[model samples]
Target chain A: MADFFQSLLGNVTNVTWQMAVMWAIGALLIYLAIKKDMEPSLLLPMGFGAILVNLPVGSEALAPIKTLFDAGIENELFPLLLFIGIGAMCDFGPLLNDPKLMLFGAAAQFGIFFTLSMASVFGFSLRDAASIAVIGAADGPTSIVVAQQLRSGYLGAIMVAAYSYMALVPIVQPPVIRLLTTKKERLIRMPYEQKNVSKTTRILFPIIVTMVVGIIAPGAVALIGFLMFGNLLRECGVLDSLSETAQKVLANLITLFLGLTIAWRMQAAAFLSPQTLLILLLGLIAFVFDTAGGVIFAKAINLFAKKKINPMIGACGISAFPMSSRVVHKMGLKEDPQNFLLMHTVGVNVSGQIASVIAGGLILSFFAGLV
Target chain B: MKKKIFAVLAALLILLTPLCALADNPDAVETCPPMVQSQLEAAEGSITENAEIPEAPEAAEPVSEEEGASETSPAKGDQALSFGESLGYMLKGMAGIFLVTAIIILAVVLLEKIGGKKKDGQA
Candidate 1:
């Protein structure tokens, strides 16, 4: 009887302060997910997985999760597959209607390169610095792929920073946008001119994008190819059911597993470090600069453009998707209730998605051989 | 319609030529400088040695440049480039992104014209 009791209590004594801290962090993430609705699909699983992995159990207990991580994340399969769904869900009509908005997407990527220099200055190795800088992509899959490809030591921190900042787009973007633009600039509204984009154009957009991106940055072919493929599935006119499954079922399934598997790196020993905190701070700086870059680019364009663009719409040119667009749209509505910037912001937002992937590819091309 | 198709095909062919060349001769791809390669090899060796003997969690602190200096080559530490070099890369990367964006925008504009023409013909 005593032996049985001892056996039951044996693991309890093994719990350390770090494990307790991880548990708290996990619980906090769960709270944020449920209460704040901050990327609940991902954060909740990541939170629960953090707790599950941080338990004082033996290595055998974590074998399954380790297997899943190795199979899904380490091999870079999940993120690519997730891209298919993302591509399927996207409606590029807004962007097609106004292709010039793509420049905002391009300009917004300035943060990634800026952060790369900053990370390098801060004494991180090139591969690790590049990986950390990709957090500015405001993209989870890109961050994961870059970190994995570069063999960055801070994969766990990078993933956490990327997703967390992506979720915090609503909170992170506004101040930076406001700081850069005046109230008058924010109020400057350009009327939306809806252009009829034909069926052939819709189908060809993905194909042309894939080819162009592939030709320019061969390293990004896989990432861009998979993304455009998903878009192709959506725009093909005959693959309606497949497109739906890709957007809903496949994306959800991968996200659920991706979130949980990410916690394998969130082990107390790996995650609890000074570097993790630095990574988070750097991630925030990246987001700030990305917002600044987009707003400044817009302000510059307004110098020559006959019709002024509401600078806030430029801030939507990060890969946080509809969230970044909605934030800018809401801010526009707040400034002038009659002003609706959703279409414009959505155009820039989708363009940002493509731009972020291209940025990721460029980073890989430039640094893959070096590190 | 034939002209538009020919234009697209020609553009695709032009774009595809380089990829085909690169695939045919992978050795043509650029590699790291010899100095950087040597440094990376040394760093990898040290990392492998460390992996042989697992340390306690407390030892898992961030590897400072000074700490890694012993394993790194004398010319440059574990960093692939200095701050100055990274700035150069930044300029190049930003230029590359803008260039690609410009090309894509041009392509979209051309496609829109073609699509519009087709729709008008159908009507």
Candidate 2:
């Protein structure tokens, strides 16, 4: 009986403030993911990862799980392979249907460049600054790639900021959407016309994007090429089984590893640092500035147009998917019930998927050369 | 080649100019040489440096294979260039990515405009 008590006390010796903080963080992730339904797959695994990594140095509980993260995530291969599933699952139909939405994609990226400079001024190096800026793109893959390439000291903080902001798109973007546009502007209803992209165009797109973006941003080929390849499988019609696996099983598997591995980087010595707090602060700023850039750009374009585009949808350009679009849609409903920007906003949101990858390539090329 | 270089410069202009202008003491900043490789290495430990610039194979070929993968890969590393000058090369690498995007976006916009105009004319 005494031996059992002593062993339990020995186990409890590992409990430091750092461990407590990490446990709190893990619990927070669980609350947010489960109760709030924010990026459930990502947050749930991340919570589990945090628990496993911080489990008071116990035996038989965490060895294999930690090993899984250590082997794949540290090598940077997991995130890259995850791209194949992300690529394949993406339905470029909305984007291709309204190719003009690609401008919004470019518009969304303004935050990345904007945040890069701001982060630099805040005392981060160019590479860390660049990685932080990618959070504005609201793309987990792009953020992971940029952070991985830069090997930012605050990788955990940056990852958390990127993923959390993505899940909070509905909350974060709505305020910005409301601030940027007037109720009158939100009332601008767009006519929805779904264009049927031909089989040839669908089949050729991934190939063309892979070649074009790959040659230009060779650093991004691993990510964009796989993404486009996934789309290729999706559109090929003959590869339905492959596409299904890419979208469901492969993506699900990779997402788990990615989330947990990121949590492993959340060790106390790293997590409690001031730099992490700064990274999170900069990340939020990126999202805000991105929304501002997209809105201002659209409003400027609308000045030239006889029929103005709904400026609220421009916020959706930041690629939070249904969340960003929903924010725009909700704002629109507030202004006028008949006004619906869901499809248009979704169009731009999808374009953001492509744009963030392009931005990642651009940043990689720039700083990789600098280093 | 010249046009391509100019285009890279143009893209860099769009991305970097705003921040450069925001630096309060431009003259003071201009006076300093670029953040050299050594300084960056020193800072990496003290403040966590992120200066590693992955070099493209073609440009990186002249360096020893070790440095081809790491820092000191740029040709003018031994020389003291200005901040903008060193950053210019890094921006070029980044420009390589944006250049493709800009060209694609511009092309699609142009085509859409032309097609819309033609439709209006027919109407």
Q: Across residues B9-55, which tens digit of lDDT does each residue of candidate 2 receive?
A: 46745653322221211232234455732442353221111122222
Error of 1 at A317 (Å): 0.7
lDDT string for model 1 (A1-371, tens) is: 98999998978999999999999989988998999999999899999999999999988989999999999999999999999999999999999998889989988998998998889888888788889999999989889998899888888889888888889999999999989999999898779999899888899999999998898877788888889999999999899999999999999999999999999999999999998999999999899999989999999989976778898888888889989999999999999999999999999999999999999988887667655
Candidate 1 CAPRI level: acceptable
Q: Please list the residue runs of candidate 1 whose C-alpha ends up more than 4 Å from where it truly belongs after superposition.
A: B1-77
Highest TM-score model number? 1
| Worst-scoring 10-residue span by lDDT in model 1 chain A | A362-371
Candidate 1's iRMSD: 5.4
Per-residue error at A88 for model 2, in Å?
2.3
Question: lDDT of each structure?
Answer: 0.84, 0.70
DockQ of each: 0.31, 0.11
Taking the tens digit of each residue's C-alpha lDDT, what string does model 2 give over A31-57? Answer: 999999989888887877776687677
lDDT of 1 by residue, B84-116 (tens): 667656765776677677778878888988889
